[model samples]
Target chain A: MKRLWGPASLLAILLVVALMGSLALGEVRLAPSEVLSVLMGRGSDLARTVVLDFRLPRALVGIAVGASLAASGVLMQSFFRNPLASPGLLGVSTGGALGAVAALALGWTANSIFALPLASISGAFLATFAVMALAKREASAEHLLLAGVALNALFGAATSFLLNLTAGRFEVSGQIIFWMLGGLENRTWSHVWMALPGTVLGCMMLLPLGRSMNLLSLGEQGAQSLGVNVRRLQWEIIILSTVLTALATAVGGVIGFVGLVVPHILRLAIGPDHRRLLPLSMIGGAAFVLVCDLITRFLPGELRLGVVTALIGGPFFLWMLRRPS
Target chain B: MIRTERINLGTRLRDVSLHLLKGSLTAVVGPNGAGKSTLLQVLAGLLKAEGAIAWMGDDLNSISFPERGRRLAWVGQDLHADFAFSVRDVVAQGRHAFGDDDEFIDSAMKALDIENLADRSVTRLSGGERRRVFLARALATNAPIHLWDEPTANLDVRHGLDVLQLATKLRNEGRAVLISLHDLRAALCFDQVLVLDRGHLAAAGNPDDVLTPELIHRVFGVKARMGQEMILELP
Candidate 1:
């Protein structure tokens, strides 16, 4: 228990620093003091518009997306009893990406701003349920993973078909490509409202399950002997992880690697006690995404947030795979 | 403290019924494919068998998972740790159904002589050390009925003897203990012995009466001469 405090404190400090950096280092580049004054409601209208109206919502959305993805990752890793398991392993992100792409290709976004996210969320749920339906009777981790793999392939192919159909329409194709690459650019309070509440509530629901998840590391039969209803826990893990991944992808597009990388690092830093790992991963994930988003602002080109994270996380993931556990 | 009536699990376990009393040490002995492990799993409620299993007059199936956990503790064969959880954390898992009981966890570790390895990751432990860690976890449960499958499979001779002694001690404390073992010589020390052959209960009674040379030859296909403390096999 004492070992958890150091990492917890470190993650909290990093989150605060990242939040400050995110708010202060945008195109307007306000000083820390100016940012604080604006937060305190004593700055120029332009500063308020930048910090309060624009940057604040974007930062909050970044935190929500990051935390949700990480928490979902923790749940997935625990459920599968494999460190390689991530939220996207269940095809939720691919489904969301397919939905967003289909929405754009079908000219649904011109109808309403809400069309894309709604369609994306619907796609995610459909994919997850399809995997569940295929693997429901046995409900074994291996079965679920195999089903997820099949669904991911199906969704990825559909997404590619949609992209191909829009190739002649450069504007629609470009929009599809940008959304697939993921970003927090031009995010508003509506985005924050869409992602934050579900993220917070879902994480809170996951907190009490930490102990049960820890027992689950012993394998399904072992956990069952320890009083965990393995079937119920499996369902809960699936529902929570899918909801979190769906919400994150709905708001931020197909952000990858945050879910996979953050939990793995936190599990190594602290022991695999889910009670501590779950909350700490949430903080670490938020900090990581905020830091990554901040990098997107300072980059030379129009680099997407997802591209920067992949650039960082992909190499780290490879290094992890190469190293002996 | 356990009673089963005609428990059948596919072809793995045939209709088998037995009664276990508290404060008694019972050993389930069998040859390869005799369903010893399967019977233990059925009693542990890890596998759902046909027919009925009751503990102290309560139906095992009707009990909630948590409630059943509080009453029965099990250590299965082929237990493996894939994650880097500390030995202490793994042992503490035994107390999961009952809440954290540090004293019990510590004592369980001490009983298994693994207190020094408490902070070490179970994934890094040797096979024998991992076996002891899992045993300690089951011990930490403090359940009324204990079931162990091949509890001494990977243990050193001293640790194996220690485990048998611990089982005896648990029985002495008025808890029921059931173990599936291949060591017939060790089974001699148990108060009662159950002989299984091809998912059938061939015999159940006092160890001295059930472990006769004719029965041993019939079930194990080994011509053995039973002595006071050991069984010598003939080529």
Candidate 2:
């Protein structure tokens, strides 16, 4: 059937508009033609730096982060096969948060821009392995989610305890606050250089598996009979998704809603075909995060990034969750 | 063709010998909870059974997934249609293992009389229609070896008979079709028969000699009476 957006294509359009919105509707606005001129590299050096150097990286990073989070969300939802499944709820973002918080506390991230992502990737991988081990032997959706909850609570409490201990002693109060809230602020070409490669590579790995995942949606036994090696497939996706969530968090700091909410909305629009669903979410996720980031920059008063995302996402997520089964 | 030797892997299948020739109709019949389904899955290599399941002297597991798709097809009990895919999509998925086989898919759908329901969503189909679609998918594989688990379940008398008749036709066309049946009356039409009870082979061979009233009573806890036309029925 010909669809309105087919979820995937609709998200692609939204991503372009959002990218334009980020470039044109910033604190200092620019015209669409000016943005296009800058995009095409024909604009003056001042416009070029202002557009390409300042806004382009921000917009591109938002898309990268958004796509990463959305892709992570799809993996979690498919692995658990639950609409409510999100990287945040499953403690994956929490792992990234803990990793960032740890690097800040240990004074390891001060020397290089790379330390944050490196530490965060390590933390996320550790959390993933711990949960996998805890739920191994007889793992199902419920058991995996439960393990995620336990890890989330434990890591959350530990992160808070560390913050409380360093509230005065470390003199890193601002860093702690930023670590918790999540942002795309002051993100430069260096951060992009570090994160974009892994994010793109991860997507490449995941895209091929989309058709295989379509088979998996029929349940593990169904995939197995169709010749899918279930355990290997599960582990591969988990590892790939973990890396994406970690790198995004490492680069952009725990951006919420994009990963958790985008896929559910897309699924409702397009019947689940991962070949279509995965790429669609990539574009949709980028648009959603970029819009939220732009809105946060001029929200009347000083607004925390996580608070802005939460204010918008919390209500929408609850509504989606409460929709009749 | 499909071939298996005295391929017993130790103690699991001492009495689990099966010799299904090409173009023969075979039915494994028993009451509920019998190992009939298990045997079908094992022979189809969906399970890791002790006995060997060889297709033309190639170890079953050694064959690639797509290769097996061209040679053996299995329809398990309690099928899961978790996605909201159109019926055509579900049928088309069967040909996924056999690339570029739209001809096979069209013929398979025709065989099961599901051509009319091609565009209908699988989740919306009635039980009988769903069975036919699944059967069509199996046939779409164009496999030499076909295994079906209670293909007649939930089907009305007519659909049940249609399922048996179609299976018979496939066998006549030189496909090794193994069906697990709860209906003994249908088994009377199959060339070879095996009855299972509590994971053991209760009886095997031609329906006349192996499907006696005493054996039926012992395995099913019910009396079987040979009526006017050698009908196997409960008293």
Q: Which candidate is the best by lDDT?
A: 1
Candidate 2, after superposition: displacement of residue A73 in Å?
3.2
lDDT per residue for candidate 1 within B1-235, as digits (tens), equals: 8999999988888889999998999999999999998898889888888999998789997899998778988888866676789999899899888876665898999999999998999989998999899899889999989999899998887888889989999999999999999989889889999999999999999999999999999999999984576443312
The weakest ten consecutive residues by lDDT in model 1 chain A span A132-141
TM-score of 1: 0.95
Model 2: per-residue Cα lDDT over A68-172, one tens digit each: 999988887777766567777657788878888888887887897788778887888888888889889558768878999999999999889868767776467
Docking class of 2: acceptable
TM-score of chain A of 1: 0.98
Off by over 4 Å in 2: A1-10, A40-53, A76-84, A88-90, A135-146, A167-174, A224-232, A301-325, B1-15, B126-129, B227-235
Per-prediction CA RMSD (Å): 2.7, 4.0
lDDT of 1 at A121: 92
DockQ of predicted model 2 = 0.29
